[model samples]
Target: MAPVAGRPRPGDPLDPDAAISVRGLVKRYGDFVAVDGLDLDIRRGEIFALLGPNGAGKTTTVEICEGYRSRDAGEVRVLGEDPADGARAWKARLGIVLQSGSGDSQLTVRELVTAQASYYADPRDVDEVLALVGLTEKAGLRGRTLSGGQRRRLDVALGIVGRPTLLFLDEPTTGFDPEARRQFWSLIRSLRDLGTTMLLTTHYLDEAEALADRVGVIARGKLVEVAVPSALGGRETAPATVTWTEDGARRTEATATPTAFVADLATRFDGEIPDLAVARPTLEDVYLQMIGDDR
Candidate 1:
């Protein structure tokens, strides 16, 4: 089959050479188009985060890549093979953890993990898998019996038990508390250290910044931009918002060189800049601005 326009074809460039690649991916729902000419490349062992508003086409794009849905038009390769025609072998090479994981809610965590491991030819040690996700203590508990964070961890354990080279995490920490979120982040880092490529989607901007080596933002059914989280939308170049209190009055300014401005303000007041805080636009700030502008 011919590749979609402005996208990589199945035989071009050859992706077993690349971990994941998508070209001119198009998905539509009746009169509404969900994805428009999307193209992306994800290298092995990198955590790539997909970001967007509620209906910005993030989930639809992910579903297509996962082979859960076929693209209306496009050629996609995951783990170096076309996901649309992906086989059992290709499927086993990848792990997927959805927002709602396969909970044999009645099945113990150990049972679920063991069963998943059985599906693969060379799976990770069940015990090692539990340890990797920090769920050893709860191994005996049924999936449904675990707390939200614990269930999420079990979900992750199941994903890795098969020793997949690539893993997909969809809003893995949606209901987690602060500490739980941190723990999950550590687990993700550990997975990356072990050479697992990850594709992540999250509503939490901080989560994206913390876990993703790079992020792609989608707006209005199209990918508007992609960059390292810290540098998205030239956030690194955007001036810092400097705020201070003088004569009991608060003042602020956007400056390219905050340190210089701080020093000058310090001299003007002949003392420390009162209540001074130099804040750069955060990934969240930039993301919100971009999405708002697109709308």
Candidate 2:
């Protein structure tokens, strides 16, 4: 059995420039390995999404970085401090918005945000934080009375009230309706614009695509790949599928040069190609293929 907390290995120094860094990370529970020799780096002021199927090491890895769980062996740093040894000042620089909303039903939104702000040395204005999360209108409402989406917004408000330089958001928009999800995306982008480095974990591929500057996929306790949303697993250069209606029947073909294929189809039809569509692999497509290969 691996020990819960171990010293950082020699030559594994904390990187001042990185928002979060890990090297040869290992974590185990009883006899089962949860994280195995994983390496990751998240740059400053970027939104990085860690994606994987259930039971993958995504949560374990995040927990380790957040200092909520101890690692068996590794060098893990968040905001240039070893998480296992992070002091109160270091912890103040990080914010975590969990998957579930806060369970403090008695506190009003304003009171909760105000109380949380008191913990930080230089916290954001309480009213400003509420406005940032679109909760100003419901400031006096008790936590239990808010709708699901509103509750999630309050979670974000609490997370950002400290003005943390780094934020961890796990499944932030899980229960939001379509419009609410889009609104949440805008809010995240606004935070990114303010230079907040973010680590996001979500099962929603579309959410990852919309928010992540880069995405890393984990499988079976290992990282499969990491790339920008457009290029993850070579999605940007994947073969395109060209489709059209021909003689009242649908026809399709995969080709490397979709523009050339469409030009040829235009010539063959003497003008317009009927019901034409050209598509390349989406982020979801590449992600599924990556996970499939890992299995």
Candidate 3:
């Protein structure tokens, strides 16, 4: 498949503004190829979401970028340095939040963040980090006593306390309730405002649409497409589905020009259309179509 439009083609010069860059990345387990010639570029200060179903090699690709796994072939760069050779200083520039929180700890929120902060040469203020994650009120509470949402917040606190320029979030809002998930999304946007570049991996299509500046879908170990949520797979141009109540029964029509269709419908109704709803293909719809068969 062709690389997504606007992405760096293979052998192109490294983008100085990119926080993460991959070219012809490949990884194998025995004879099975997990990641095959994947190429991706995440620009600085943008939230880039990597999405794929289970067994799609997204996890392995992320691990390779994180320096926790080796690649069989290809060039991978995080923060302008090869992750395989990243030193203490290079590692210090990164923050990672896994799908699950570190198990309940004996330390209070403040103490846990304080300890995490000490590892960096210049970390964010301990109190500031806690407040940023909305855990300040729970600072005195031990980790084991916090609720699920609070624990997730604490995870983010620890991740950001190091003042990392680049952060990796894996299913950050997994298991969160609706309200809590929205709260977490707000926090992610705030981080972006602070100019922190993020690479997020999640199964939540809505979350990716809400938070990411751009999203990439991986399937069969290859990057199928990369685009802003609005334009992915040409979602913007996909036909719209218009549904309404007509003749006492529900009627549906697919149209390329919803606005014109609705205008005619209004004239037919002489003023107002009954129970009207016009919707174009959603991000989820486009995503599913892009990953079809591969799933």
Candidate 4:
């Protein structure tokens, strides 16, 4: 069995009206604590990103919120009800896209989505959902026949067929190529425009920067920081890494303001700085550093 992550942090007070509230949340496996007194506030109609290194409790936390796993202790309210005790009707208001397990593969895309809609009181039109996911062209294709990216899109289509108020996207772009990932991002934005509150867990920091309004970073199972992407892990304040070429030798420096440094370098060289480039930390760069994976 995978070891339970035991390092969830106890943070400051959270605001009321949070769509998902977790206070003092704890989950255990015999002698180990998977989650420890974690507190988080996911707001309504906003994209909230949950991130951590592998085995850092990201998946477990999402499962607990999805009502698929129970917590040993904590106060969790998802969409005004405790998910542990939520009814089917309450669940219909949520959309979840997991990595696998929609294998009615012999079924057509339309059939698969339509079948899921039956569980909801009122579902969006199957064709409309397909169109929303950019899969309308392949609606008649059997699930097994679709390409990997297309199949992933169908998984998402099924997730949103009910027009859920809150959506949980678990690594939606994991297997997607760069182009497919960009296309998927557009579909997510469309859902967001409809006022769907989203909880997104993604390994791809670029994906988070593109989608999340705020991001939380967890390290060794503990949430160390929660902030906007530009400022996550002090990314904005971390010194800029400036790169240039002088006498055909590449050189660099870490400084507070690369622009000012570049200006001075330009005067020293009496011209344009050779191969000049000012670099700030990409979301991935800062994320790797935070996770202790910097090399």
Per-candidate TM-scores read 0.93, 0.93, 0.94, 0.91
Residue-level lDDT of model 3, residues 1-295, one tens digit each, is 2233466667776555589999999999998999999889998888999999988898899889988899999998899999999799999999988776777899999999999998999999998888888898999999999988898889898889898999999888888899999989999999999999999999999999999989999999999888988999998998999999989999999999999999988888966788999998998898888889985
In angstroms, the error of model 1 at 264 is 1.3
lDDT of 2 at 257: 96
What's the lDDT for candidate 2?
0.87
Cα RMSD (Å) per model? 3.9, 5.2, 2.3, 5.0
Task: Write model 4 residue lDDT over 141-174, tens digit each, in one string.
Answer: 9999998889889999989999899999988888
lDDT of 2 by residue, 253-275 (tens): 99999999898889889678899
Model 3, residue 82: distance off in Å is 0.4
> Which 10 successive residues of model 1 have the least lDDT summed?
1-10
Best-fitting candidate, scored by TM-score: 3
> Which tens-of-lDDT digit does each residue in 1-295 have in candidate 1?
2221122433354344557787777888998898987777777778989999988888888878788888898778888778889799999999999866775578898889998898998999999999989999988988878988888888899888988899999888989999989989999999999999999999999999999988989888877777888889899889999998877889989999999988888888765667989998999899999899666
**Worst 10-residue lDDT window, candidate 2:** 1-10
Comparing 1 and 3 by TM-score, which wins?
3
User: Number of backbone collisions per candidate, in order?
Assistant: 1, 0, 0, 0
